[model samples]
Target: MGKIEIVEGDITREKVDVIVNAANSSLLGGGGVDGAIHRAAGPELLAECRDLRSSTLPDGLPPGDAIATGAYEIKKVKWIVHTVGPNRHAGQTDPQDLARCFSNSLHLARSLSARSIAIPAIGAGVYGWDHETVADLAIRAALAEQRERGGIDRIRFVLFSKDAAAIWSQAKLTHLGR
Candidate 1:
């Protein structure tokens, strides 16, 4: 089974096999986690995103879908899996859509043979999802994937704030009954 841990820090600096970016549908880099990952990964990341847009996702990546790109400058990370989470007020009110972000990212990571991945709180930032909901959905998705697939070794929820970390920690405990 895969182990899940909550870490309070910047997701951009995580030294893992893959880093999950809570990206917008554009996948061209927006505010929050997407911008951070793009910036941290340097201009090469943007260039790659542009290539993806021009070739594959010309209409832009849709919510609940994920794509992987080379982690050019981010130290110790091989790939950056970008997933778009549902925007609640923008008409994407389905919790399942939010959950799909994690599942799709994990699936992409597994396809790349990634052993460990660091993920941020998808949909909880500018997307307007509540912290508790984000935490619950993220943890549940990870745990479900672990049980159903059982390939990835470790999953880390890297929160940018102490408050977010606390919420994720509580959710983890609540879900695991620990």
Candidate 2:
């Protein structure tokens, strides 16, 4: 199985093959992790997202699905995987939908032959999912993906706050052990 790590750090600063953006359905950048990633990656990233809307993903990225884009100016990141988590406030509370965000991101990372990836607390922030639930879902999805497909060797869950890191760490231990 691939190694899973819980880190208390900024996702934008990760030196990994891929960084997962907890994006909105628009993929045009919003608050929290999405805005930070777009700002760090610069205008090119936004342009690419806009181009995606104009072309292939005209309907915007759907929740639980993922799409990859160039990291642009974000140092040490080759690709950015954008995923829209289910918004609890919108009454989209299916656990499977939240789980798909992690699984799809890992699937895309493995397809790209990414050795490592940095992901954030996808729906826990503004999307209104509880930290404990998101943590469990994230860990479960990552482990499932690892078991089914093993190309992606490292999964680094980069949490912004200590509380989130602690939650994810505990979930990691529960699901993956020490």
Candidate 3:
């Protein structure tokens, strides 16, 4: 089984095989983690998102679904898996939708033959999801995917704040009874 870990740092800096972006449906980049990732991954990432928008994902990506794009200049990562998390403020508060963000990202990573993935706490920031709630959903969903696929060896919950990281860390410990 893959191990899930939490870290307090910039997700863009992680040396994982893939980094999951908390992207908006447009996949064109927005504030929070999305914008930070776009900025770090550079313009090539934006161009790929534009291509996705222009072609395969013409109407933009939907919430809960995930897509992969080249990481471009972002060091140490091969791909960026973008998943649009449900926006609770917009009445898209279904836990299943939130869970899909994790599961689908993992699915994409497994498809990409990724050994490790770094993910942000999707929807827990400006999207209005409580940190603890997101942590629990992410943990459960990721574990389920790992069990089913058994391809990824590491899943990292990367947070920008120490408080958020601590919340995820504790949630994992509690969920796994460690």
Candidate 4:
């Protein structure tokens, strides 16, 4: 295992073994992080997603579930892990479901033997969960998973905005004390 790290910046610019896409259950591109990931990864990414939807994932999977695809334009990673986060409804996020997204992503990365992975604050965007809370959940899940599996070298929380970036930066200090 490698030293745990917390970085503040745009996910698209981060160099890691893989980056996660907070996709909709349909596995097709939706708004917020989902849309941005698809757009950044390029049209081929959308095409591959559509091809997967047409065959591999016809009816769509449940939230907190994830799938893998080839990294399109993102230079650093060889693969992209796409996971559907629980939509914010009725008030707070479902803790178990939200955590599943993080855990499941780590599981996929571990299975792929990835040395490092980058993730965004799941459910923090249009889902409207508090950034600090979501980042804590993400950090906790990744650290826990890595502790058990023993392969993941690093986890990066890539933030799209400065406010969200600050939330993760503070999260690192509060939770990891680093």
Candidate 1: which pairs clash?
none
| lDDT to native, each model | 0.91, 0.91, 0.91, 0.81
lDDT of 4 at 23: 84
Q: Report the C-alpha lDDT of model 3 over 25-46, residue by residue, as the tens digit.
A: 9898989899999999999999
Residue-wise lDDT of candidate 2 within 40-80, one digit each (tens)? Answer: 99999999999999999999989999999999999799999
TM-score of each: 0.96, 0.96, 0.96, 0.88
For model 1, how does the per-residue alpha-carbon lDDT over 1-178 read when each residue is reduced to its tens digit? 8799999999988989999999888888888889989999999999999999999999999999999999999979999999998998898999999999998999889899999999999999788899999999988888877886656889999998999999999999999998
Error of 3 at 42 (Å): 1.0
Question: In candidate 4, which residue ranges exceed 4 Å CA deviation?
Answer: 90-92
Q: Taking the tens digit of each residue's C-alpha lDDT, what string does model 4 give over 1-178? A: 4655666666777788889988887877878777877778888898998899899899886778888998888777778899877777745467888888899998998888888899988888677677877888887887687678566888888777878877777776776666
Which regions of candidate 1 fall more than 4 Å away from where they truly are?
Answer: none
- Comparison by TM-score, 3 against 4, better one: 3
Backbone clash numbers for all candidates listed: 0, 0, 0, 0
